[model samples]
Target chain A: MSTGAVIEFTSISKRFGGVAAVKDLSFTVEPGRVTGFLGPNGAGKTTSLRILLGLVAASSGTATFGGVRYRDLPHPLKTVGAALEAASFHPGRTARDHLGVYAIAAGLPRTRVMEVLTLVGLAAHAAQRVGGYSLGMRQRLGLAYALLGDPGVLVLDEPINGLDPEGIRWIRGFLRDMAAEGRTVLVSSHLLSEVQQSVDDVVIIARGELVHLGPLSSLDTDAAPQTIVESPDREALAAALTAAGITFSIGRTGLLAATGDPALLGHLAFTAGVELSVLHRQKAGLEDSFLALVGGGHTL
Target chain B: MTMFLRSVSAEFAKIFTTRLWWILAIVLFGYIGLLAGGLAALFAGIQTGVISPDAVNTGGGPTDFGSLPPLIYSFASSVGYVFPVLLGALATTGEFRHQTLTPTFLATPRRGLVLGAKTVTLVLIGAGFGVVALAASVGIGGGVLSAFGVDALLQGAETWLLVARTLLAMGLWAAIGVGLGALVPNQVASIVIVLAFTQFVEPLLRLAASFLEVTAKIGNFLPGAASDALVGASVFTMASPAGTAPLDWWQGGLVLLGYALIATVIGYAVSWKRDVT
Candidate 1:
């Protein structure tokens, strides 16, 4: 893309007391794409988002927008639309008033409040007090507040949290559409699978470090040449493949080989008179990389 | 949308839309009614010969100082206005209660602007309470006096002057509360100390100060005494049971205003520089 909001973090580190919440963490969030900020709890995902928003100062390094820190931006709300935590509203304020304040702060017209309220499906309930709003409604309100000025870059921390199934689907579709419009969308969540299909590029962080940062397509294990052989005469088939200098292992049901293509493995199976029972190639789901990135303690 | 003005607007919105804010409003109005009733009864007993003519002649008469002046209006401003002061303080401190500070900071990144907004709104709320309390105090005090046959108490230009000064004094007391709100951002601590200072501490100090006239003179500079000079009566330097000091009205006003300014500035400093979220 020729243009979009480019968020770059260089050697960013933040420490609460002696414990390093995020230590020497650095990554570039690109433009016009959904960058998934995947991390487990206490993995500094929230902390890093805070630093980017300037809620917490970094011990070292910088997180810049275009090339400037968020605080340094001439108009922060117009430059970066951010939804950090959903419960940002004053409990007594109505949903409309809640967004009204932010819209005014962003120097946008007051009507923007109504527009955003409607955009987030909150128009009908705009008069309801935030104290009585459901968690799903609060999340929508948070998004409305963030989108008050329609900033180019959206930085959301666990925006899908507490959303119902329908809310989740709507959010995924909305985020995809926003990114499709050549806007940079950086959203973080504990559930990797939730964003697995939504995001174009993934940036997973574990224990305050970047574990992986690349496109999802690169993780297609199915495209990696794999071989399969099945036989009714399993014992004989295994021995014959070994004798033919084919490195294969006893798969869950059939036999798996590295050197033999599916067709070649089929021919070998026919020559041995072993009736083929099963043969298939496997693709790597996001689950494999997810568990590989975050362990059991934070997987939940 | 200057950062400063935006912050002030947000602060107003935050304080305006809370049950705690409305509770404070209720307490203010309710307290004003009580103080008016108390002042009325105190004046009535004096008029009905409960106190000797000696007390009446020295401007404590059933009708001599019978009118509720600006200073009296200060005392009567709001019985429960202190709650809003507590509310404003807690609003700032409550950011620490939940994880809400993170989102607030995201919305308005500059902490100083946010604090300034709070300061402005607190001052406004204090002023608002002051106005309501002043109106109620004057109206009820006058009604009580008239009902008890002391209608001629403020029979000249003095009565009108009392009304105007009472409004100004009410306004001043509101500012003083705002200052206190800023100086102490903790709800319980600030409310307790402010309420205690007004009721127990100031009254006690004035009583003790009158025992030593010089000390009473010094005590007259305290906020309660200063506001009393502007409203109705001050216990610190007057011959009342509260205490006796020789402080004139202007001196007391200056002292209270000084405290309000100092508290407000310090509150802004603490909130602006420190981490709010």
Candidate 2:
């Protein structure tokens, strides 16, 4: 797979009513890789995609696809295929006709409609109207629409929302393959852990602002292999770490301690003769990193 | 050009193929024909003679189309005006109702182009309905007229002109509907307003025009008044027993055109300014 089209957002900002939904955000999505936009609800993940697609007017910043404004693009469908949040189907139009109209509009052949339908596993219901579709089916149809143009870039918003486990697995592999083909893919989801397992890179937002932006590897930076220790001398271990200035968060299960090195923590414990009931380096999961980035939009 | 035409063809297919649109079309044609039949029955009882033979222009119609029968032209104008309005509203409001516009807008990205294609579709559909409606009205109403030994004026230049006039008036009405559809973008609201003006309000205004001296004059510029000019023998809004100036067919046509242009511009303005989602 080739790394394909490049998109850049320069100081993009958008507001609704009195609230700023996206604030002075700047990021780049390069070709040939999957970039995950991770945040909790209302973190402005969907807003950014809308702006990129020219669906929403940006208040202060510009989002460009391949250095061109979305409106200026000669063939928008062939350039960027987006399924942003809403599964906007003409409920009365059959699936084939729904895709067929877009194909005609995009100047693509009719056969491509069947191809996409088959690809998305909507072939059996191709004659069915969208109103009867399940949430998962609607999502597949949305993806079919996005792929109709064979676009160089794919922008999806919370694609896994109502998908079952198998469906989610299929999408993850499909996205990976598309990115492998060198197409630029941006997938946004409120579930960071799910994205972390599925994405190579990420842009984290919190309360309408950028909190973290980097590879999934970055989530592991503050990560440690963790074990729940219920030692009678738990107080002693906790005191030792505190005196050593090791910062630890006390979770419901146990005193969550962070260690610079697991070997050192073990050596220290062995020397101190602290009986080990449970001890291990804490593993940093994408879920924790995501929760830390966006402390829940409304409460924050 | 091919791309534009292709999109237009697809649009036509969508509008023509949908059950709602077809139902609306059947309603429009049947309702107008039914109203004409009712009028034919009422007028047959009252006089059994064609009241309009001399050409009169009230709103937007071509004077040269020769003098058309009063009921024939009136029914055409009244119904024609409504076709475009419903078409316009249906074209845009359907998108809003079905939420298909997102994928549409996404595929096009050029909002202006999509809007342009829809405008073209509106005109095409309007003109088509105009011609078809004239045939239906004339064929049905004219036959009823001939049975009363009043077939003398059915042939000649006046007859042809009336057909052309019906076409023009109906096309304009449809365009106005398109504008309302775009601006409202809601099916229920669009239908309510369109139905209200065409049915209840105009009839009430026509009934009151005879008694109210000033309202009689204002009623001429109303939709029904404008329609009466094209449909009736003389343009002074003969539909209602109100005092109105006889606008030449050209003048009446211009008034309808003006209303259509204003509505279309406003529709585009709203669509352009609103967020795409």
Which tens-of-lDDT digit does each residue in A1-300 have in candidate 2?
Answer: 112578899999998989999999999998888999887778888888888888889998899987988878888788888887546867777889888888878788899999999999999999998878999999999999889888889999988878889999999999999998889999998777566667889988877899998988887666465544434687777776677676677766666666546666666667777766666656666566667667743323
Question: Against the unseen true structure, what C-alpha lDDT does each candidate score?
Answer: 0.70, 0.73
Supply DockQ values for each candidate: 0.41, 0.53
- Candidate 1 lDDT, B1-277, residue by residue in tens: 4877877776777666556766766676677767775766575656565655666544543354433343344454324335444555566655544344555566677766665566566667766666666556666666665666655346567655555554555555555555565566565676688678766887777667667667766766766666666544532333455345345556656776687678767876664345434
Q: Which stretches of candidate 1 lie over 4 Å from their true place?
A: A1-3, A218-268, A294-297, B50-72, B77-84, B94-104, B152-226, B229-232, B235-254, B257-272
Alpha-carbon RMSD to native, per candidate: 4.4, 5.5
Best by the DockQ measure: 2
Backbone-clash count (model 1): 11
Residue-level lDDT tens digits of model 1 in A164-190: 999999999999998988888999988
Candidate 1: lDDT of B45? 53
